[model samples]
Target: MDVLADINEYLNPTTARWYANRGIPYRRGYLFYGPPGTGKTSLTFALAGVFGLDIHVVSLLEPTLTEEELGMLFTNLPARCIVLLEDIDTAGLIRVEAPEETTESDDKRDFNVGDLTKAFKKAKKLDEALIRPGRVDHQVPFSHASQTQIKELFERMYTDDLPTTKIVIAPDSQSDVLTPPMTPISVEFEKNGHGGEESELEDIARRFSKKVPENMFSPAEIQGFLLKRKTEPRKALEEVGEWVRGMEQVFKTA
Candidate 1:
């Protein structure tokens, strides 16, 4: 389906008003499911950008995400915003057989399925209520990016128009060890200096883009790797293949 077009139609002002006039809930819910390394998160980001909406992502697996907290989160959301609940399946919703006997030691044990199920049910009820008319207008599910799309995404990660900084090495004649610069790199290049720096960044981005394989990694995986190498873009590009191989080996062994 043309997901973007469908979302646009659903978000139209007239569509919402029509639902209200019919005494129907105006909310919409979508479910996207796929294997790991898919573009589910990326699609959500794109949707938020298109709608000019702020996104609040909640991880169901978070230990602190209690039922009351979940309700508060929905209650306090802006009139028009995207609320994302990721990894819903892992949120402890599975059915479990309750233990016949209980002891003080049971309270000290990690949360079992019974406890999780109750919490999950409460959260689910809150979700249903929040999605009714006048709240949570649209829900969209994301899937993995295509091979071509994955390549493009990796390319953009490096080539996007982001602020660039230059590192200046100090001479060793004046000191026995390297000293920190008085000014931060961001402050030093607060204003435009020249086109040369931009061109250099673009070059680096291109080099990094070439190193990423098509459909080999998910957006999240690539992002995690880049965050580790944020201080050294060139190093990220140089070592991405090695890093990917190591991750694959670990997974294999596991």
Candidate 2:
């Protein structure tokens, strides 16, 4: 199963149609949100495989990226490429005050109204440009692909059989619209042999102040979850269901 095929099958057909037609200049906005173990970022790259587009990944967590810096980056992206900005929930939403702060927890607090407003303005401006029609269109939201989406994602990645048609045009209207494929790259996991890929690494680094130890979760967990469900997407949904149920229980108790 190729990631693109799974994407074609599981992703909203409207997106595929948009991609195939090259209808807009705006990029498709994908929101991949989930707990630590889920493979949100991996799917971005997998789609890269299918569309033959390069991926330009950015972290909202970068220490030096000002709101303007972010806006400029989004504005200047290559005509066709995947621009990933993970941890939307926390980017400018949380901040640690300077050491001179007097009160407890001031050192670590969810951003206040002023900061959030600024960040929101920046994000809104960025999204406005990025999600516009034609520049870059086709959004694929990656989460813990409920048994179904997970199956779809994996099938896209590992499945051997899928329906595909390669249309070769000599630089026509749509040819300029399509993004080029990402170059071959490999990640070297740690010497311990307990490692994860670049997406996992990006997620862990972005989400928390510290690195996520390998055993707790990895991008592969999504695949493992799918396999454990015997590749039955509905059955695989049980994994997502269990987690949701557990959260429900904890909230109920609290």
Q: Give each model's whole-structure lDDT.
A: 0.59, 0.46
What is candidate 2's lDDT per residue for 1-254, written digit by digit as tens?
24455445535657766766886433445544444445667667877877787888887778888989888987888766778776655664533333433464232212221232222233233344544555434543333223334334443433323223444555566754443432211212333243444454343223321121222223465455445643333333334546544544553454
Output the lDDT of residue 126, model 1: 35
- Measured by TM-score, how close is model 2 to the native structure? 0.36
Work out the TM-score per prediction.
Answer: 0.50, 0.36
Write one digit per residue (lDDT tens) for candidate 1, span 1-254: 67788878888999989989999866666655444556677778999999898999999899877999999988898767777788775666543445557565443312211232233343233334544545544443343333455445544554535333333355544444443442322222334343454465566666665565543455677777777755455567689778866866664554
Separate clash counts for every candidate = 2, 19
Q: Please give the RMSD of candidate 2 to the true structure.
A: 16.9
- Model 1 stretches with alpha carbons more than 4 Å out: 35-39, 54-79, 95-146, 160-216, 226-241
Candidate number of the best TM-score: 1
Candidate 1 structure, TM-score to reference: 0.50
Off by over 4 Å in 2: 1-25, 93-254
